[model samples]
Target: MIELVRPHAALVEAWNEAHREWGPGLHEDGFGIGAEDDVDTIEGIQAWIARTQQESGELWWIVEDGEVLGGIALRSADDERVHRFGHIGYGIRPSARGRGVATWALGEVLRHARSSGINPVLAFCAETNAGSIATLEHHGAELEAVEQRGDTRVRRYAISY
Candidate 1:
């Protein structure tokens, strides 16, 4: 069974394994990993985990049977960054893709959003990401707009609870 849990040290090895599967990049969405964050060492991992407790947002790891599969985050709507990136961000490990994990994880996050009074949730994805687009649509998200952000065309979606 899939479960969303807070980042913890006990699962550091599993998390790193999943991270390695993604190779080197700062694009692991839902991890709340900034360019300044280094999750390679124990200290760095603990530091990143501690930072997740801050007010910016909440990050959860997608796990099943003690294995870290992915991560999903619900960003505070009040956050200024939400204006450009939207309220939700997520990414599944390449090995964990095509298993309805994103779809299920998104639903769970939306439930949390509803309880937090976020009302309508906004999500954005690359226009070329068919998997992400499908996941959002599966949750009844409607396209709000497609805007150009840097070199990528982003598709914005709004999901109402």
Candidate 2:
């Protein structure tokens, strides 16, 4: 069974390890892996955790049998960029891919959102990400629009509760 838990010190190592698997994208984005050069250290990870927790949203770790599998985040769409990006985002570790983990994790997040009175959640993914597109469609999300950014395109999906 998979469970969502708040950011904690005990899971810092697991989070860092998962981030390492992603490589060079979000891991360096201050919320991903180690926020600083010493992220491998306890202090660095702890700082990263603090910063994430202090952000304007909720970050949850997807864990099963005490091992971190991935992460999902939900935030209020207060930023103007949310018009392009979505209000919710999720990602699965490479090792956990192709096992319905992303689908399950997304379902859990959507369920929680609906229960919390967050109707019509917004989600976005790169147009080239077939897996993500399929997951969103599997969950009955409607394809609202697609925006072009530089050479890439992003699909916007609206999930209504």
Candidate 3:
């Protein structure tokens, strides 16, 4: 099962280790495109998590059963660039990839989004990220736009709550 949580120091530690060793994993398509920027340290991840959680009603969660298989962040604290729109970002450890953790955590995020009254969350995944694209589509997200970021192609999708 997946649990939504506040970003804690321990989770940050795990994410730091995992991201450092194998950030891209199978999600290489998102490496420098429509996904999270590469984070290399525990302190950096902690700060990012704290800022997002404190400033934007974002929840940082560990997809685990006593072990952190992956990490996910759900954000609702929109800015001038995001107030009416929300974005979700997540990743699984290299050791835990292909276990459906991301898919399930996203399902949890969708339920949380509905409860939080943040309907129609807009998410961006790299066009080459077939796994993520398929996962989002399976969860009922509809492709809304395809755009370019630097040399990468990104596909935007929305899921109405």
Candidate 4:
């Protein structure tokens, strides 16, 4: 079974494996990993894990059995970044795709948002990201528009609790 769990030191190795699967870049969306956050070293990983606890948003790892599959994050709607990035972000490791992991994880986060009183949650994905687009649609997310953000065309969507 897949479960969402808090990031912990105990899962560092598993997290690293997932991280490597993503290759180079800080594009692990749900991890809330900033460019300044170092996750390559023991101390850096520890510090990054600690920082998650301090952020305004909540981050959860997607774990099945003893392996880390990916991560999901629910950001406060009040967050300024929400205007562009939306209320949620997520990613599943390449090895874990096509198994409904994203769909399940997204539902869990939407529930979290609903419980927190965030009535209408906004989300965005690359227009080319069919997987994410389908995941959002699975939750009944309404497409608001498709806008250009920097060099990428992004599809904006909203889900009401």
Candidate 5:
């Protein structure tokens, strides 16, 4: 089953365990973890998540089957530069790939955004991430632009109600 949940600092342990990957993509084509140079410890992820919730009212959900298989963040309230271009982000634990979990969770977030008065939501992913790109389009997100974050590339998609 899927859910939209708020993660606490305590869940940092789970986030750390769940995020154990070379990166956060379902496909093995060319997906790599973002911000490789940055700290990826549970403490760091917790701090980042805390700030995201405090500043943007974003929430986290565990996409799991009794385990934290993957997670998604509802970032409607995020209007910072990163969010201004792409207000939402999500990832599936490598073990849970190709199961339609991402599609369901993203759809739920979009519905959450609409009901919560967050118009014109943004969803960004790597340009080469066809699975993520397909998921966004499947849920009605339009490709607004493709951008490069230094050497890394990103595709920005938007859905407006």
Candidate 6:
């Protein structure tokens, strides 16, 4: 019952609610937050969505029924840094965790990647994030390498389409 849909202004309220539930700083861009670095208004949120569309980056809401369970983003490999961090990132709501949401969401993202001619997507997680590592492994992602990012060690996984 899970599906991916493009981010839209209409979903701002729901997105903000989810953010509040998840605590602060869940999204890097501050989708619904009125922070100096994050979007402080509906118009700002709309502009952020438009920028994602125009920048060759894809952001989608992971929805079940009509509620936003979480979000996932996919973008082309733009530089060396992107390769190290992985092209896909995702987060599921706290209420929806341990229900296979991330595993299913990642499967859908990889399908889209394959359709777009990008085989074997890269996904990186901190070695301390056992849940994320397990999720990546569940999708047949192989441990490619481990690299140091700042003072933390990041495990890089390669998922083939």
Q: Rank order by lDDT, top first?
A: 4, 1, 2, 6, 5, 3
What's model 3's TM-score? 0.75
Model 6: how far is 113 from its true place, Å?
0.9
- Measured with C-alpha atoms, the lDDT of residue 10 in candidate 1 is 98
Scored by lDDT, model 4 comes in at: 0.93
Badly placed stretches (over 4 Å) of model 4 are none
Whole-model lDDT values for every prediction: 0.92, 0.76, 0.63, 0.93, 0.65, 0.74
Model 2, 5-83: lDDT tens digits are 8879888778878878877555322133433435656887777678778776667898887778888877655645346
lDDT per residue (tens digit) for residues 63-149 in model 5: 354465566666545456446345667777677778887888788778778887877887788988887988999988888887889
**In candidate 2, residue 36 scores what lDDT?**
49
Best by lDDT: 4
**TM-score, predicted candidate 1 vs. hidden true structure:** 0.97
lDDT of 4 by residue, 40-157 (tens): 9999999999999988889999999979999999998778888877899999999999999999999999999998988789999999999999999999999999999889999999
Each prediction's RMSD to truth: 0.9, 2.8, 4.4, 0.8, 4.7, 3.0
All candidates: TM-score = 0.97, 0.85, 0.75, 0.97, 0.74, 0.84
Tens digit per residue, CA lDDT, model 6, 1-161: 88888878777777766666777663432122224434446777677677766755577888887778888777776634357547788888788778988888888888888887776788888899787898899989999988898988989988885
lDDT (C-alpha) at residue 35 in model 3? 36
Stretches off by above 4 angstroms in model 3 are: 23-49, 81-86
RMSD versus native structure for model 1: 0.9
For residues 30-134, write the lDDT of model 3, one tens digit per residue: 111123533455555555555555555455555455455665656664544343223676666667767677788788777777888877887778799887887
lDDT of 6: 0.74
The collision pairs in model 4 are none
